[model samples]
Target chain A: MNPTLDKLLGGKQGAIGLAVLAALILVVFPLLLDAFRLNMVGKYLTYAFVAVGLVLCWGYGGILSLGQGIFFGLGGYCMAMFLKLEASDPESTKIQSTPGIPDFMDWNQITELPMLWQPFHSFGFTLLAVIAVPVLLALVIGLTMFKRRVGDVYFSIVTQAIALILTVLIIGQQGYTGGVNGITDLKTLMGWDIRTDEAKLILYFVSAFLLFGCILLARFIIASKLGRLLLAMRDKEERVRFSGYDVASFKIFVFCVGAAFSAIGGAMFTLQVGFMSPSFVGIVPSIEMVIFAAVGGRLSLLGAVYGALLVNFGKTYFSESFPELWLYLMGGLFIAVVMYFPNGLAGLWDSHGKRWLTRIKPKANAPVKTEPVAKPVAKAAPTPELETTP
Target chain B: MEWLSEFGAIAAMQGFNGLSVFCVLLLMALGLAIIFGQMGVINMAHGEFLTIGAYTTFVVSSLTEQYAPAFGPYYFFFAIVLSFLIAGAIGWLVEWAMISKLYQRPLDTLLATWGLSLVMQQTFRSIFGAREVSATLPEWLMGSWNPTETIDIPRNGLFVMGLTILLTAIIFLMLYRSRWGLQVRATMQNRVMSRAVGINTKRVDRMTFALGCGVAGVAGAAFTTIGSTGPTAGSLYIVDTFLVVVFGGAASLFGTIASAFSIAQAQSIMEFFMSGSMAKVLTLSAVILILMMRPQGLFSIKVRK
Candidate 1:
């Protein structure tokens, strides 16, 4: 019985344990927290989804996509459109409170909704669009950019430019896309009162579940043969291309996957918050997502989640407590994180944990040799890369 | 005959507006081009420097209104100089403390500077509320000149154009003629070789960054005369600034000037017919198309492998 227990707690058993722990945390967290706090946590977890995508693309794929916000915004707007349609009077197809149409559309006198917005009226279609739109856009962009071999700073500039353009586009199409004010004051989702405690809890649970599922999927991909190919491409793009692999295709695949993840995050974000706007897809939000991944440590999926939580929690706290000083704190944190903890919070854990334990128990040093066997392989791989490279 | 004359007059007015936009774009892009082209850092906080300058100008105007009415129109000039210094000092400090450390990782600098930009924006927002501040332009700067009864050109816009030319000449001389300029160029071209030759590459980097930021501040000061000043005014210039830098090809002042002229003209001309947002969309679409056709931009510098 002891031997069976040991086996269950060893090797792949540890990963299973971590997964179970994560699942438990996700499932039980909202139950403990109040509705307001749970909603906020849900938003942060949605951001984590975007950060996780960034970790895969920017962290591992060596592609600095500054337009993840564009995907996030697209997903959000999609969901918002459907929710707005759902909440509207069925016969009139317009909410009486929102005169003519959305505020932006009032100026243009767009009394009739555009043909494209028709699909969004359905909950199921809107849900599909929340995933589909960002992925489709990312696929197109990735295909063009990677196929042309636009990497490094050039890719960064192009993506940033794309984000700016998208923001402008959304803002300009105020009739359909709610200009700068964005779509807000959403009261219901598929006949459920979104403002109620029960609905908020449900949304929180969905976000947590989606986050966990994404982490698992990301882990699976990272561990697969395709994941190895991605790492090889990141490490040596030319070599990978020379080895008969379609580097562009691989990049596009990863980029699309990342975009899909970000879209799911965005969908969850809008549903929880009951709002969507052009601000979500702006350059600032995009940069913020990248920073979350960077400060958390890009190499590990867990790092992305941790970074999003830490940075966002800091944002909420600072913005609420010391609004003026928040920017300074954020800047200082960015500089400190980059200079001191390039590997992020996870790196700090790996570096200091052993020493801390040793200091606490000097007599336990006999088992020092056995400690290496228990360490995650992911933590070990990065050390060689750091030493060998810059 | 009357309709033809009216069309001609409208065309001329738009041409002047295009030139005005070009002047602002040129000033903003020159600084970005120097940083991105010379040193491979895309200083995302470049626009925030502009904001600082604008705010400084606003404060100067307020101070002059309250305490020193005698300073009058010249107060704008004083604000411009002070803004340059203030922005430059901050830029230098940032370069020395944070940016200098991240030279090995250019992309990381993008994120760091972005964070810095946000902080600056929020700081400004907290200090000056979210509403747009009316930057008081002296009567002399506010009025327009009527070359003909039908053709009225803004006096301040003309000032901006003249300033653009003067600043361009000054920057050209400073970059090419000065000894420090040579050292900066040397470091920009090859850091290892410059170090081997006993050049203070670190000092050059800080100075260059500060100088670029100073130029951006000046652009912002110049901008207040034409546009509204606010906490998020910097965001308006960000896209145009990047477009100018990327389209001009990084590192080349000549390319920046050329791209700024072309893109600004294209945007203004399109704006004459279409809505402002549509015009921006058209302009960006043109830039993307251009980039697709010429990935290296109009002027590609020779990079040593």
Candidate 2:
């Protein structure tokens, strides 16, 4: 490997993990899997976005948000709104009472476009909103909760309520939000028919590229000096505060970042799945997203993606064959994961796989190991879950 | 004069509706308050245990009506006791197998119990089928009483309220006035010290959990009077039940009851004017706001952080 490329990859393990993930997602999956299976993988990758976000928020920052689906849903809805507007042009909607509004709104007897849906008519605005909406919500929530030092279980519960509230609000305001069925019949993006097989294949690559870009961006953030603070704050927040840091801002920042990541995933989900709905924006899905992060190894960004895919894969297969057995298996999986494997998949890899990586390439051995970055993460390992990672 | 009477009748009905809702919530919260307040173990599966009580009632109700029609009218009392014992036994097994090792980790307990809830729900679906079931009530539980030509109340509502009150009084007496209460309280405050003083805190923990679950079972029994039983019924109520306990102050029995009363009443009254979902959305929003404003909840006891 080139010296510059080696430095870019950080270590031998990092490079190998990157190659395997990239090849599988970009080349192997698309080649081996049919269009239907590829679309399914695309759908699963959308969840990987949430899992990665969870790795930052819960695994690193010690904030377990059970409402990530809200942000993901918001992002997806923003994109869906744009697509729906394009599909529901006056020419296409002439059969409805209203000639310009969405079919659902027209069906529900909404004569004109609602105030909120108007902005979504602009693709540029929708693009901005896909990231902005969730980040803004997280900002307010984090500022309110973290400033008051309401955290851990309280934070988790409050997030769950937010998810519950959002779902109820959407279902209740069906004329505006598309209700329990959600914003569906999304057909195109900027006159390009997203419903076509070729377009879906393109969308798959676009999402795959975007996901890898996010992984790189997250890695950049995690490798910084600020990343060290997140680890410190997770374990000994008092010491960090006593050491004279504004803890609330850091907490808020990581949460916002996580929200942004989830939003991106949600947007991609709508593009690939061809719909955005309340089914993805609730407590059950949100908690399931956390389990994805947890199973992937909360501490490892790469592991989160695999975790999401694996869990969803298992779910799809199991529910198909034995619907009655699915809940028991899923329930038992949660218990088993929590009880036995606190460190998750990545942590398991680190214990065993890291040694092999070092053996294969001696240059991956680092002077960074001499520093204090290693200690706080070990301390952050609570009784049931978590393990140190650097 | 007619309009005034009409208004009074509506108010009277809504008040009973609220009171019935309050009774259900209080019965659920009381059990939660005991376990959560004393041990600080958040049981996400508490709702499932409540389902256990409900299904037990359903089974007994069906059996008596089918096998012995003469006993159908009187089998409810027997069903309640059976509900308590079955739910309590499950609680004991759960405590021994799962919760005992997870005492030091509250959040993990939440996750594990959640898993347990899923398993319990699945078990119910497999055993009873997925559709909702209701018990055959005795003839005495039939009909409504009219205080005046304009005002009326369901007999079942009043019966449930009566049952709730009886259970509450019994629980309060047992938990506060008895020697066992002293031991439990002692263990709750200082586990190590209580053990040093020969309190057998472990036994207290198991008994406390069993008692809390047993109470939840009775709540489930009372629930059969007003609502049908389904596998997911417990789940539908779990979040609201947790809110009642937390908003009332996790450790305070009176607070739990007070909070439950206010929430239930608010929901019932709002339900008359708004969509049921909207009413729930508003109530939950208010509760969340209150909790954020006073993170300790409405009636929190001062303890060293």
Candidate 3:
């Protein structure tokens, strides 16, 4: 194997893992599921974008932000605003009091578009704002908290508070933010209808490809020297500070990166789902996003994707079959995962699944040289214990 | 001067409303502070414990009405005590089953307790049918105390405030002037040393957690007088309760009261001027900004480790 290829793909096992996941989503899911079901999977993959980011920030960087939904909502809202503006052209919205503004604005009796919503009219600006708005918010939050060394449980609580605040702000400013119902009836994007079946299929493939790009980007970050520093900071913050590193800067960077990933996911979500709401910007959704990362094996980028897919599948299946049982099961999953499976699905695979693989590998006449998976991730073994001790 | 007098009356009314809010916040924050400040554990299900108390009170009220109509008015007092006991007992059980295993992992405790809260919420929905329920207050708890022509204060507000004062005093006395308090403080400062000195540190932890949850239950009972109880009512206050505890400095009992008082007053006064949601947003934002500046909170102690 080429050294560069080994480094890029995290060895042959990791390469195979990536291929299998790609096949499962891009080929298998699309082929098997109908358009509606395929759209739902695409929606779940969008969340996987946020999960992959959490792998870096929460898993490796040791910053568990319970407010990723804020970024996701912002990204979605930005795209929705652009789409809403296009949908409410003077010709189409001739019936409303205000000929060109969104229907909600007209109902609220606003004659002119608010200064805040002005820039979102441009598709180019909306696309940029999707990532930029969330990153900017993350930067502000990260600078204030990380610079002051506010972290762990305190940081989580503060982020949760921010989620609450954002939700309230959005709801209170209903005239501007569409109240609690969020930005809806996002009919078109650049004159292209998004509600059609063909459009949904195209959007699904687009989301899947974007998600792959994000996963690769995360993998690249993890393979860099900065990844080692993140791990080091997580294990021993004081020691890293003592070693003359600006510990907070690295944390801020990783957090901003996580925010960007979530924002992209949010944008894709608006495109596919047809609306964005404050419901997605609140504490519950934020915490649920964290669980996606937790269930995926926070340390494993690939595992995060699978975690999103699996948990969402269970959610749809259970909620449809037995609505009451879903909350119980979800609550139980949260407890069980933390208590028993701290490292999540990938951890289980590393411990149990890899053994089965090795057993079958010999029988299949595979070379014994592919034994590096065990050694590479062995450093992760002590982290769960370390987290508990802290 | 007439308008000025009217403004004065409005201020007085809103201030009293703020005071009632302060009582609820203080009651909620006290329990959280004890668990978070002293025990260094984040019980995310603390709010659900409050809900448990509310439900317990509801059950007691209905039972009293059915079996003993004459005992209806006095049932509230009994319900308050029962709420505390029931919630404390559940807290004790939770500590044994889950919290003890997670004593070392504070973050995991947050997630697990959150899970516990979800389960509790679902259970409430299952039992209570998801509709908001209110306890039938006795005749004395209804109506208002008219201090003047323009100033009318709800009798229930005064009752809750009085209850809050009684509980706060008891908690202070217990923490400062009791043997159990000493054990809790010792365990808080140095668990190993406390254990070595013949203190059953585990018992202290369980009792401390139970005590915190019991206070939350009492808060819930008090809550029934002012507003209706729903499955998610407790969760609505959880974030605010946390902010109050955090803003007050996690370890300081006095700070908790002061912070809760200030925050409640600020929010209520703002509500008088602006939308309720905006008031909430402003209050929380101010707290977060101040917290960012003084991350140790309003009155954190400096201890040399």
| TM-score, every prediction | 0.88, 0.93, 0.95
Q: Is candidate 1 or candidate 3 better by TM-score?
A: 3
For model 3, how does the per-residue alpha-carbon lDDT over A178-225 read when each residue is reduced to its tens digit?
Answer: 998988998988989999999999999999999988888888788888
lDDT of 3 at A172: 91
CAPRI rating of model 1: acceptable
What candidate 3 gets wrong by more than 4 Å, as runs, is: A1-4, A363-390, B1-5
**What DockQ do the predictions score, one after another?**
0.47, 0.68, 0.84
- The runs of at least 3 residues in candidate 2 whose Cα sits more than 4 Å from the true structure, single-residue gaps closed, are A1-10, A352-390
| Candidate 1 residue-wise lDDT, A138-235, digit = tens | 88788777788875777788888889898998888887777888887676887788888788888887788788788777776776678889899988
Off by over 4 Å in 1: A1-17, A20-24, A91-108, A121-124, A185-195, A242-244, A357-390, B59-78, B123-139, B177-179
* Residue clash pairs of candidate 1: B37-B250, B37-B251
| Docking quality category of candidate 2 according to DockQ thresholds | medium
TM-score of 2: 0.93
The residue-by-residue lDDT of candidate 2 on B1-305, one tens digit each, is 99999999989888989998998888888888888866788898999989999999999999998899999778999999999999999898889888888887676777788889999999999999999999988998889999999888999999999998998898788878999988987888788889999998888999999989998898898889888999988887777888888888867787888999999989988999999989999999999988878877889777654
Following a full C-alpha superposition, what root-mean-square deviation does model 2 have from the true structure? 6.0
What interface Cα RMSD is found for model 2?
A: 1.1
Better of 1 and 3 by lDDT: 3
DockQ of predicted model 1: 0.47
lDDT of each: 0.82, 0.88, 0.91
Tens-digit per-residue lDDT, B1-305, candidate 1: 98888888888999998998899889888778778778888788899999988899999999999999988868988988998999999999989878998998877888778777877888889899988886789989978898878889989999889888988998889888999888988899899999999998988999999998998889889989888888878867776788788888777788888999999899998887889998998898789768766777788778874
- Candidate ranking under DockQ, highest first, comes to 3, 2, 1
